[model samples]
Target: MNPQHTRAFAKAAGRFSNTDRIDAVMLARFGALMTPQIRPIRSDIIRFANWSPPDER
Candidate 1:
């Protein structure tokens, strides 16, 4: 995993509630399991283009 992803996971893990600590653990586990396939964001323009205006059908 990249340092940015690892750091984000650490920050998220730190925010878990006491009763929901297991959910945080699960998030960490899933982050590791899924990180290998994660791709960098490509183009913001393409994303913006694909978004519809509020009045559009």
Candidate 2:
């Protein structure tokens, strides 16, 4: 999450005080309002490939 956006949203909501409790509420509200889209996992991840050349085996 972007810190600038967080601060901006909190400030807009009249939550200038940056505290854990206040942040929790702000973030929860942000999530509810924004409903960010889910993305699939990257396909670049390593996978098992145990095969070797027949001659070498």
Q: Candidate 1 on 1-57: residue-level lDDT in tens?
A: 565664566567674344467655756785766656756777997798799878765
Instruction: Kindly list the per-residue Cα lDDT of model 2 for residues 1-57, writing each as its tens digit.
Output: 566777788899998675899899998887788775656655554233544466863
TM-score (all chains, Cα) for each model: 0.30, 0.57
Which candidate comes out best when scored by lDDT?
2
